[model samples]
Target: MSDGITKIKEEFDKKVAEIKALMKNPQQDTGLLSNSVDFRDKNLIYSNSDGVFTSSKDKIENYPAKGYPYKRGVKLSFSADGTTELEVEAGGGDDLYGICTDIDEFTGMATVVPITNNFTGYLTFKKNGNGVNPGDKLHFNAQGELEKNGGNDKSVNAIALSKVHKLTEELSIVLASVFGNRALKGN
Candidate 1:
């Protein structure tokens, strides 16, 4: 009957829409192939709350941006008031939360790409008193810029992935998950 065919077509369309939605947020669609080994073993990156493909180990969440139009790759901190704030102090607290991925101009929301073991993005580092070399352990400075860790007291957030000799020249860094804890040796 025509009615039966129409119902089937409508069901098919609904299923298709569900699949597309699951692809966008696979974690929420636990009914599909989420339990399959193929999906688990693939280590596939999934879209986060901001529709950004992030490592399966990390979750990028949107936050109310205290200031709109944050530069991509700038360090962001979670404030006590529950808004994401731009870093301004030097080693104040464990304010080093995540990096800014994207911003919604209309909503003034910032997508925070969490720093996790799977994080492989590049970070810009600032030159310290002795300059920076590859393999140097880095910590956040006054402007949330990476600076050489003078000793074990500072949190080793990242390791320099490139060399920088001049004040104007900037370099990239890799997140130091192994030694990223704050005051690992002193405390």
Candidate 2:
């Protein structure tokens, strides 16, 4: 009887571990392909990846030092080909890649936008010049801002992890999950 109880406890623990793992990788735990998934705005102002739940102002001084800051941490003065030189071309490609997670309540300025992946979190980045819906799909335009997903362009960099509640406010910031690798393009 004791052995049976131990086995049951072990099985329960294993199932618990599996559920925790699923929550940690919300992006992957689902069977719905990125294309078929329908994202919705759940009004989640900030998640573990977005940093602390403080008023936007309080987060400003904390921004640069934060784990998933929007701006790129390093700049490349040379091309990846060892000694080939390159100039610092300004635009979008150099910054973070997901969606905007937080904006100042009063100023309406965007604050947090995480672009990279981690052992346990999703992220956000800026929007492209055009508008996007919650589940509309997205990718990096040449400038690096989130653009409509490229069907087969080899640059389909990400998928909208959540929907933007456009009726409430224009989606100045969006929450997204980056594609670890390039996925299919639509056109």
Please provide TM-scores, in order, for all candidate models, with all chains considered together.
0.47, 0.34
Q: What is the C-alpha lDDT profile of model 2 across 31-112, one tens digit per residue?
A: 5434343475333335433443222222221121222223221112343456554322112333433333344445433443
lDDT of 1 at 118: 36
lDDT of the candidates, in the order given: 0.51, 0.42
Candidate 1 residue lDDT tens string, 1-187: 9999999999999999988865755576676536565534332422443233355656556666654323223345456675556431122226555655566779766666555433434444554335666677666554555667786666666565556444354533433322323334321
Question: What range of 10 consecutive residues in model 1 has the weakest lDDT sum?
Answer: 178-187
Model 1 TM-score on a 0 to 1 scale: 0.47
lDDT of 2 at 108: 35
The segments of candidate 1 whose C-alpha lies over 4 angstroms from its true place after superposition are: 1-54, 68-93, 127-130, 165-187
lDDT for predicted candidate 1 compared with the true structure: 0.51
What clash pairs does model 1 have?
A: none
